[model samples]
Target chain A: MRLSYPTNIRIIKVPCTGRVAIIHLLKAFEKGADGVFVAGCLEGDCHYQSGNLRAKKRVAYARRLLASIGVDPERLAMYNLSAGMGPRFAEIAREMTAKIRELGPFLQPSGRTAAPQATAA
Target chain B: MIMAKAKPLEEILSYLEGFQRILVLGCNGCVAVCEAGGLKEAEVLASALRIQNMQAGDRRDIQELSLTRQCDKEYLAELKDKMDNYDAVVSLACGAGVQFMAEMYTEKPIFPGVDTCFIGVTEEQGVWTERCQACGQCILAETGGICPIMRCAKRMMNGPCGGSEKGKCEISVLVGRDVDCGWHLIFERLKKLGQIGRFAEPALDKDWTLSRDGGPRLIIREDVRP
Candidate 1:
């Protein structure tokens, strides 16, 4: 999905982005986010002090995993900004959308999405 | 910390393409803290997959469940009733979790959401480097806690391999230190413990049968199991 794709991009606001984990980013892609980015407070400026740094670390790890999985690591990103940085948030969105446009829609094997409905064991 | 990269997005995407519903499992242990697999990873992957499906115009239902620990039976037990609800179980835990989940449900396909890399330790914040081979032996008292099984170029038990170049192993540049071999780290540690002599003792071959050969391993506690 392109960042510009309607409702494709989601921003999950947490107590802090550091609360986000690498798998969360992966799941997003697995579920289908052409690109994902985490926007947190500026470095050394987290309201919770270490939260932004933590978010950065998590995003880094997620990007690495995305790259490993054949997903463009560029699909996932982290930015530092205050909660009120509307412009910064928009910038992230624009950047991500552009990246996704280049990568194209998530290409799954078989060009299918639905696995067989899970049957009760 | 093992430097395991996630399976490329294409690979993971392809695996889930045919599945209608997917459950992404997460472990809060090693992978969680390192930002690999954990609650956060489960949520993120779920979200990404959902978006992927949606944007692709696929109507698959991607579900999720994150447990505190996938390696532990007690922890996995939490999902007993919920296991059958999903088409596939995408375990964010290491490879063992995939097998465990597959074993538990026998019928459902279990997938390793996270590629379990190697036995490792955090070299720094969010940095994991492999340290152990888990050859079914515990000889850390000898090597100063540095695992030669993983650190040595040849997984040597005796000492530095002939290929060890200036403390660096021929296997990779990452395995060595400029002035100190990983062996040095182990020696220094043992020396501090006044256990340097223990390093000289030989290790008997570890019995592989004690591990996977035992057949489906089980640790049932009457108090916990019904």
Candidate 2:
């Protein structure tokens, strides 16, 4: 089955979303990702027991980290779906893409505007 | 260990605002075990600062370094050559380490990244409780190995006080937690040890001058001096 998501959305897979530390999420924003989200295994079905649950907590912490730095916490999100749920992944990709569109470009550390999806293309 | 908590990002950011270069100095001593000012925490703070600077459209060169022990002059001297490379330092050490860094780098602005919370022990993974007050006098032997000066709300030498009830301190009720009464703990432990009769000896008033009231006391053991 060939499932297609928004072109603006990029996916970076990991062994488990638990591996996604708060620093990684913040680094994404620092490197000019206007929006970032984590897609973890379903809440209780993580291959490494409680890995997804830990990811959920990391997502919450990342949101607080974003808010602390004056960035909109809404730009970052967490979604959980089993590996068989391709439609769910596509759905979240579309959802997060729309959110970034609403947020537009973020400010870069060099006092320059980050290139948005359209500008990057 | 001296337990501490990271300062709010906003407060820490306020210190770095307008500074182009920053050094996040971390201590791997008591603060590390407390999960407040370790190398990992220093890196986290640095990342947060970078993100914050990016959001604010400002540039900052933030470096993270964790010393073996920031309170020691030898460990601090390791950074002497690199100290001039930054505009300011955000020390993630205990109050003592922060002061030592300030004294060592007189020209560089030093800011605290963590608030020195208390002299306590980790009761569990995330819970810490005060265990000592360093009152310049030891009375644990009399109190069944519990220091009332640290555990007691009022530092009572002999008491559960009039406000104690149900073996809990009144301050505990106000703080929305059941804090064990220091005197009650003492009495129970002494009774358990068959030493309750030793309570006949009245405890003398603690000398206030020996504490912080005298403004930073110092102990010099000349025999141990190198």
TM-score of chain B of each: 0.77, 0.97
Error of 1 at B114 (Å): 0.6
User: Number of the top candidate by lDDT?
Assistant: 2
The digit string of per-residue lDDT tens for model 1 on A40-99 reads 777888777787787787778667655544456766667677766666565666666766
Tens digits of per-residue lDDT for model 2 on B55-130?
6666679889999999999999999999889999999999999999999999999999999989998889889988
lDDT per residue, candidate 1, B116-174, as tens digits? 88877777865777677665556665567677656655556665656655555554655
| Tens digit of per-residue lDDT, candidate 2, span A3-121 | 88787655676888878877677777767777788888887788898887887888898788778878889888888888889887777777778777767677643343322221110
Error of 2 at B117 (Å): 0.5
Docking class of 2: medium
TM-score of 2: 0.92
For every model shown, the clashing-pair count is: 46, 0
lDDT of 2 at B33: 97
* Candidate 2: residue A98 lDDT (0-100): 76
